[model samples]
Target chain A: MSEEKKIIICRCNDVTLEEIEALIDQGITDIETIKRLLRIGMGPCQGRTCLPMVISIIARKTGKSPDEIKLPATRIPVRPVPAGVLVGEIDEE
Target chain B: MKNRAEVIVIGGGSTGTSIAYHLAKLGVDVVLVEKGYLGSGSTFRCATGIRQQFTDEANIKLMRYNVERWKKLSEELEYDVNFKQTGYLFLATTEEEVEAFKENIKLHNKFGVPTRLITPEEAKEIVPPLNADEFLAGQWNPTDGKANPFKTVFAFARKAKELGAEIYEYTEITGIIVENKEIKGVKTNRGTIKADVVVNAANAWAPILNEMAGLDREFIPIKPFKHQLVKTEPLKEGQIEPLVCPPAWNDSYVLQDGEDGGVLCGTGLEYGPTYDMTPTYEFLREVLKWATRIIPALKYAHIIRQWAGFYAKTPDSNPAIGKINYIDGFYIAAGFSGHGFMMAPGVGEAMAELIVKGKSHVPLDWEWYDPHRFERGELRSTAFQIG
Candidate 1:
């Protein structure tokens, strides 16, 4: 029987480890550039699920500390909210 | 470490990359520095609508040249930009809007833009899903369309690199080294780069860069506003036609993505100046209400994702593109408001010409878009600004 393909990274955008490795092989070293090229951390979750994994991958491949591999800029509203809530249409639960 | 370049452009969005490409093509040693990835700013979040329809002649003429350039962009850049001239349909709901469109079409025709005021039935014929009864008339322009922003920016970046331009990613410009009102160089997080000329194409973050050079007061009129857009699940191709816009309906617009069949929709929410790019549920509810009302079929479409971006809005809703007279080698190409992506090509070509040849090859009144216009109380406003 054939082995099942493991889905380990970027489940929101369906970016796998193999794809990330391929981009790294092509001389893309920056985490932000990789995110833009592969749309890995750009899904609705906004990199929450896969950013740490991507940082580790880059650190390992580049032989640098994870701290040296800077993460992408994080903007406000850390949590995704419905449009209504953003516009002050708060529901009293 | 220290580096030297003739010109340093401080942004990696479409405008900055295009400027770098044009400058490199002109044989100028240019380096483009991006704090983030290319197109990670407003370029990636744009609705990608490229239209020539405008109320003012200057804007129409600029867009006319831009549209022409967009048509041959793929060939010039040696990359497929996926520019589809699917047409733009501007619906008029009231008699007042119809009258306004009549004048708009007249101006459009004067500038050689092939736009015509069509009846409600003709509008339906173009976009079958449109509710014809909701509109009185619509102005349709066949040449207006959408392009893939990611491909377009990469095309410019690749071409620029091919033409001997250096691009530095993950490089942040922390300060501008200015002395006696002359640009010396830019201090970056990576290292200080000595540059005689500097172009501020930072878009939403233009104010910060301008402030670093002590030119913040001149750029005070430029502000940032957050706009949200939602994408629905991919549907059958040809289910929708043309970018349908109801300007009278709070500046709401809808279009189907060319690469993916997802229906993209958004509206001009009355959000104040903010750096927050949070997608609001109010925007989703409002956009869907207006979208489904226009195309009833959209009611069944489920929103897969929503995102927000900042528009570097100017007081006049027009861009500030020209050399700053007070500063010798500092050029401003920042205040594009919401239409930077559409206007990037023209602005790039003009800025390159001005920098290399000391004047634009195009017959644009460069003084009209001067960065110092706000200080002089001279503002040229555009009428057809949608969210």
Candidate 2:
């Protein structure tokens, strides 16, 4: 309920625009590097909403084509799963 | 006697503006109208991938001609469309797909498209990061390319306007005035304009527009199918190069805007029939999952945004590109499904030729793409990956 507009650049990891900008300012402008450093678009939602916005900002500042940007890796089941299921303990013999 | 045109082309996408330009170039008085902003509909929604690899002779011919035009689009239109010849890699991951690609390549080579059947190693050389563990081969057409859909549409509209053609924005065509099997004019939300010819170039809403003319519902079976695209932040210098189209793993395609360096990616999801424009969470999930699995390097590529657009499906995947059956001066340029952008330049010119000179010089068998082909049980399965 925070009235602040959370610039959720990565719906998967709930990364914010401010965080991405800070990383870019720190000379970590590469999308892959940023993902490795901050785990931004690595979550289940992937970089769906945030990918283009970040690309636009970078392109505006650096004058690059969105095509030059490397596409994010796709995972299986492409959808999200329940945390309970992910953490379920298996029977030990 | 005032503020009238001989032909009023509806919809402001590439098809409409291009038709208007060709007509005006042929000294035909033309007026182009749009309900929304120009290039905002399917044109902007397009991934802008253009290629010349099809399973048919006529389509290959049309796309080949379009590629020729795209080469000099900037010079002809006097504006830069940002046309990039980064080549297209249609990856095949199965034996069946490889068999299909053989036929496609045969047709392409027959029509001088220069598509070659390459081994997975060749595809890996081009893409480098492709998951080549399981795939037969792919069709690589180096002359195939991508472009800026928005800029191209704007360039067409600007050129059309310069040639004594009137373009009205924010104007909606509510009804078409047809009497005695002839088009009289169109009734817009603003006012009525009389015209001798009315071309329905509205992409997704083409069926509804045809209904407005009181045409038969079976005149064109154009249905809407939604697809999603996502983009990532700019990559480091040499991670990936050029646009990628994988026919094996999924119905997914990838392209990077050279100007922005952001990776624009899309996939034809298994979406059933629906006109809703809402971007679903499911779409995001599937697109990202495939992007990661196919190119493992994109595992961390931050997704910037996602969007959805509709494809107007015809009984055949090819569009209904000519005149309506009995309605004089009522033509159709819709039902491109998802491949409209690639064919826009050539289609516009062909439609213009049909409108002005009664025939097109592109040498396409007009009978196959005709709107009347459906009723004659001459249905064509030209489109296979219709997501």
Candidate 3:
């Protein structure tokens, strides 16, 4: 069943189910390096829309339950903010 | 994997993996043990600037060798590590910085690295988006560039594995098995793996590992200093090829090649030697203030994340490499300060030579990185460091 599915798992990074599966096949089970490599869970959404599915993909590959997998650390600014605003340089546009 | 090996390399960052690859290439039974996943340490968190621009002869020569290796690393490792020689541009703001660039350029010239002191106008031609009026002059080197840290690290690791070296990730080293001041092996969470030579490439965790081997701070002093950086969303490839940074006075740099195209900017927060990885909002403002000043267009970009990591800083900001005189079969290659990722190739190659032939063939090689030199009160000049 080597089918090319266009299933998008990490929308922020445009990471797909096939892409995550390929990394798992390479034995990269750690979510940190996985995120670093594929840019998953690192976009503006910050894993809000994709982390659950990404974790499930890894868990299924590693033979662990979805709940057993830990989510990646959430970064600051919980929502995306223009960097200039932080320095008091608000864009009029 | 195996219960024993001829050499046990601790850590799995760029340094440790590079050491493992070089050692394995030299035909050694090497086993590298890491506390976390591969490249989970500072290697993954580095600013990804590789350059030969330094203020000292020892550093200049070492980095020259490193740059040569970096240029051909992809073909050598049989992996695309994304190394680009887009060159690195240093903004000389102060009169003193301009003078230092002259001497440093001459030193780099002697070491066969073609770094030139250019005007601010010439600097803007290299990076079009740069706000040129902020700095007085510039230091331009076409050889210095950037590489994806994780890709380079994994290339070495994967190649090392292909060369028959066992790399145990997520395998924590609980203790060092030393007998009669000689390295016997290491006690890991997995089990004991015996080896004649044990290399402490543990980066920020080097001091603790050395302590387990009974080589205290008095023996080889190293402290961890935490630094933070932020990366924006990718724009377009090759938009910011050269790494842009202000000189010795300030601690910030902007590069467009952080993540294929994401404009990356970094700065050291107001902190001393500590291992705190908390990315603060204050730092975001501080780094952005400098970054936007350099390239005003960056203000429009959104930062995807802000992450922090440690710089295993020696007192002199140089790495403690080579065999430790205090321990019989123990070697160290940590405390690279902030430039370890860029220096990994040179350090790895020279260390491998020293281990196999008992002496390194490279210039300013492993012996110069005397681990116990601090104990003797002989400190080296700090390398030219920027964010």
Candidate 4:
């Protein structure tokens, strides 16, 4: 079976392993840290895929618990809503 | 009959408003001019995800400062920004991806951002509904969360106004008048206003403004890319927790929006040739597919709505900040891609510090984001890429 064709994280930006490792070597060690460092997992998807992988890497390198690392935050419109919808609904609440 | 301010700002988006707020707090006579309502630009259209995990110290420090301010934004401004620390999670599916996460976690720790790497199992523990078999590893930061972008922007603007700053909305800036290598003032629809300095916080429109000032800044080959997000009917029970998926593998993210009851969801829509912000059937299908794969429960929810916005992209996927070398009293806080909202306050504080104290305490190197860097061919690549 094609090894289940692993899911590549950071898809919106096409960030690969080599690039991420280079960032680490350059001194990035946390997912949140790498986020600001490399802008990983901050895309429109908001770290949904690459975040898991980012956590594993940080855990292995830093020897700190993954639970300790904070996750990247999530914002509203969970799905994209049109500007009109946002604007028109101003009085909905 | 009016007092000529020492500094004038253009664009009332998060960057401009925050910069005005910070400068006003420092007792600077600043006027913020916005062509439209505040936060009407990238601020309102942002994903509002503030993160500290970074490969560089400057970014880490910038986010660290912003995150700190976000936590206290409501209290400081006496307006609830609804800043929520919903926590963020990043998942990696390959060895190559895992390596990058490792390095980033270390850097965050060094910089004092509480970030940690987690196992797929542990990741599932935090976000109980995730499909653990889908990824190799993940990263987590509990303090990372989202806030109301509109209220956040308003909060800053209101505070700045109260502190003696004049914010002019519905006023468009036509150009920056530079005389003898120094800023003369800015030309707007309302007329010309003289000032010693001008900062461009126009977000996606920054390049045009930069060109107006005769400064050469690529400001990230930003094309207004459209993205889609959906909100479901309010959940009957606690069926969801706020969570973000690593964009590397998943196209969608699922999170809860506090007592608002609806589950907020978003995804990087597959790229299309045009910069159109219109919604498409293709995006809806893609979002449903990924949302189901990551969080199977999403299958039960009904998507109540959808919307679109633009991200100011860069060639290297990073932001262009700081002052222009060729122009005196000209600065930038643009090209944030989509991270502008989360990074707005910090960008504001940095610009304010630079403006008031003539330097930043966090040492954001002016050279890295120098408008001339692209000309010198000294551009660096970035790892984060999303729609």
Worst 10 residues of 4 chain B by lDDT: B233-242
- In order, what DockQ does each candidate have? 0.15, 0.04, 0.70, 0.02
Ranking by DockQ: 3, 1, 2, 4
Candidate 2, residue B252: lDDT? 78
**Which candidate, 2 or 4, has the higher lDDT?**
2
**Local lDDT at B134 for model 1:** 90
lDDT of 1 by residue, B1-387 (tens): 339999999999999999999999999999999997898878988888888897787788888999989999989999888898999999998999999999989889988998999999998888888898999999999999888888888889989989999999879999999999999999999999999999999988888898899875545477889888887655777766478998988888889887667788888884768888777767778887787778877765655678888878888888888988878899979878888898888889999999999998765567777788888888886536763
Best by TM-score: 3
| Candidate closest to the true structure, highest lDDT | 3
Model 2 iRMSD vs. native: 11.7
Please provide, for model 2 over A5-79, each residue's C-alpha lDDT reduced to its tens digit, 9 standing for 90 to 100. Answer: 366777655677677777677655666545644555544456566677778766665678878876655433244
lDDT for every model? 0.83, 0.75, 0.84, 0.71
Number of the candidate with higher DockQ, 1 or 2? 1
How far out, in Å, is residue B240 in model 4?
A: 4.4
Q: Interface RMSD, candidate 3?
A: 1.5
Candidate 3 to truth, TM = 0.95
Whichever of 2 and 4 has more TM-score, that candidate is: 2
Off by over 4 Å in 2: A1-93, B236-239
Question: Rank by TM-score, descending?
Answer: 3, 1, 2, 4
Candidate 3 vs candidate 4, DockQ winner: 3
